[model samples]
Target chain A: MSTATTHTSAVVHPEYDRLALNRFGLWLFFFSESLIFLILLLTRFYLFGTSRPEELNQTLGLAITVILLLSSFTAYRAETAIAHDDRPQFLRNLLATILLGTLFLLGVVLVEWPEAPRLGIVPQEGFGIAFFSMTGMHAFHVLSGVLLLLMVYLNGRRGAYSSDSYWGVEASIKYWHFVDVVWVFFYPALYLL
Target chain B: MEAKKAAKLRLGWIVIGILAVLTAVEFWVAIAINSALLYLAVLALAKAALIVQYFMHVNQLWHKEGHE
Candidate 1:
C-alpha cells in the first residue's frame, strides 16, 4: 500500500502542469504589454503635465469609463458561469460584454474623436495629440477585445467549454479585465488628471 | 458547487460596486479639488487592485487549485 501510494503521488498530471504554465505565460505577456502602455503614459505626462484642454468632453469620458467597467463585470460573470458549466449564462454574459465593449469603442471613435477636433483639440498638436494616441491605442485594444470575446461567444454557443475545461473562457476574461485595468489608469490620466 | 459559483458571482458584483463608487468619488475629486493629482492616483490604484485581485483572479497564478 505504501509503494502504491507513492507511485500514485509521483504520477504526473500533464494537464495541471500545462494549466499552470499557460497562466504564467499569459502573465508574462501582460507584463510585456504593460511596458508599452507605461511608455505612452510617461510620454503624456512629459508633454502635457496634467493640463487638459477645456474643450475635452468630461461627461463622455466618464460614460465610456463606466461602460468599460461594466463590461469587465460581465466578462467575469461569463468566466464564472462557464467554470460552473452554466452554458446559457456564459453565453449571455459574453454577449453582454461584447456589446458593451463595442459601445465603448463607438463612444471613443464616433463621438469623442469628432468632438475633440471641433472643440479645438485637434490631433496634430497640444493635448489633442496625447488624447488621440492614448484613446486611439486603448480603442484599438477594445476593438480587439470585442473581437476576441466574439470568437469565444461563438465557440461557446457550439458547446466548447465545461466545468472541467474552461481555460479559453478564463484567459479571454483575464485579457478583458486587463484591458479594463488599463482604462482604470488611462481614464484619470487623460480626463481627470 | 453551483452555490459556490453563485457566491463567487456575487463577489464580483460587490467588487464592481466598490469600483463604481471609487470612480464616482474620483470624478468628484477631479472636479472639486484643485491639486487632485495625488488623490486621483490613489483612487486609480485602488480600482486597479480591485480588478486585478477580484476580477482577474491573479491569485490563481500561484495556487494549484480550481477556479474560484
Candidate 2:
C-alpha cells in the first residue's frame, strides 16, 4: 500500500527530521575525523619501527596507558545510560568519564612525558620525534573530548536529551570512544613497544 | 526493562575485566619475553579490538544502525 511505501521512505530519508539530521551529520564528521587519525598513525609507523623493545619496558607509561584504557569503560557506561533514558545516571557517568579522561591526559603530560626527556630522550631524537608526535596528537584528541563532554553536560542541564532524542550526547560519546581507540594504539607504540 | 539494563551493565563490566587482563598480560610480556616488544604489540592490538567492539559498541552500531 502507499502507507507502507511512505513508511519505508521515511526511514530511508534521514534528512526529514531533526534527530536524523543530527545523527547523519555526526557520523559523517566522525568518519572524516577517523581518516585523519588513520593517516597520522600510518605516518607514525613510517617514522618509527613498528616495535621497539626498550620503550616497552617503561613502567610509568604503562600505568598511564591503563588509566586511559579504563576510562573507555566509563565512557561506555555513560553512553549506555543515555541510550536507556536514565538521565541522572547518564550525567553521573558522563562526569566520571570526563574526569577520568582528564586524569589520563594529566598523567601523560606531568608524569610520563617529563620522564621521557629525563631519560635523555629529546623530541629531536629519531624515535623520540615519532613517539611524542603520535602520542601528542592523541592527547589533543582527549582534550577535545573533554571539551565536548562539557558541552554535553551543559546541554543536558538544559534538558536537551531524552530516550527519543539524544543525538548530541550520542555524537559526543562516539567521538570520545574514537579518542579512546586512538590511545589504544598509541599506548602500545609509545609504552609497550 | 530495568532488569535488562542491569544485565547490559554487567556485560559492560565483564568487557572491562577482559581489557584489564589483557593490559596486564601486555605488561607481563614486556617484562618477561626476550622478544617482549613484538608480543606486547600483538596483545595491545587484541585489547584495542575488545575495547572498540564491546566498549565502543562499534560492532553493534554497525550492524543495527545505518550510521551514527
Candidate 3:
C-alpha cells in the first residue's frame, strides 16, 4: 500500500502541476493589473497621436526594449532547464535574465528619461505625466520581478527545488515573463509609436 | 515522462517564435503605415495572449480535472 501510494502521489503531485496552479493565480492578478494599464494606454493614445512619437526618445528606448524581450527568452530557457533538472543551464539562463532586466531599467532611468526636459516636457506636462506614470509603473513591475528572480536563484542554490518540486522557481519565471510581455507593448507605445 | 516534458518545452519555443514574428510584423506595419499607435495596442494584446497560453500554461490549468 505504501508503494502504491508513492507511485500515485508521484504521478499526481508533479511539480509542474503545482507550478501551473500558482501561475494561474498570478496570471489572474496580472490580468487585473493589465486592465488598468490598458485603460491608461488608451487615454495616452487619445491624448497624443502620431505626433507624440516624434517627441519620444527612440534609440535608447528601442535598445532596452530588445533587451527585455531577449530576457524573456532567457527566463523561458531557464524554466525549461529547471524542469529537466539541468542545474548549470538553469543558473546560467537565470543570471542572464537578471542582468538583462537590470540593464533595461538602467537604460530607462539614465538615458531615455533625461531628454524629457530637453524636449520641453516636464513630468508636470500632461503628456509627459501620463507617459512617465505608465512606463514608470511598468518599470516598477520589472524591478519587482528582478527581486523575485534573485530570491529564486538563492533558493535554487540551496537546493530548495528539484525536477519534482520547483513550483517556486516556475512561478517566478511566469511573473518575470509577464513583466517582459508588458514592456514589449509599453516600449513601442511610449517610444517608437 | 521526460519526453513529454521536453515536448512541452518545444511547443513553448514554437510559440515564442510566432510571437517574435508577430512583433516584427507589427513593427513593420508601424513603419510602413506610420501608425504605431493602433498597431502597438493590437500587438500588445496578441503578445499577452501568447504568454498566457504558452508560458503560463493557462490552457492546461483550465483543463485540469479537479481543484484541490
Alpha-carbon runs more than 4 Å astray in model 1: A1-11
TM-score of the candidate numbered 1? 0.95
| Model 3 alpha-carbon drift over 4 Å, by segment | A1-21, A49-53, B1-13, B36-38, B65-68
The residue-by-residue lDDT of candidate 3 on A45-69, one tens digit each, is 7787545636676657667867887
Stronger candidate by lDDT (1 vs 3) = 1
DockQ of each: 0.74, 0.47, 0.33
- Clashes in model 2: which pairs? none
Model 3 / residue A79 / CA error / Å? 1.0
**TM (B chain), model 1:** 0.91
TM-score sort, best first? 1, 2, 3
Identify the leading candidate in terms of TM-score: 1
Q: Which ten residues in a row have the lowest lDDT in candidate 1 chain A?
A: A6-15
Q: Which portions of model 2 miss their true places by more than 4 Å?
A: A1-4, A7-31, A50-57, B60-62, B65-68
lDDT tens per residue, model 2, A1-193: 9999989988886543655455556667767977877787777678775655364337677676777767777777877787788888888888887888889889877776786777666678766777677778888888999999989988887778876667678778878877877777667666654
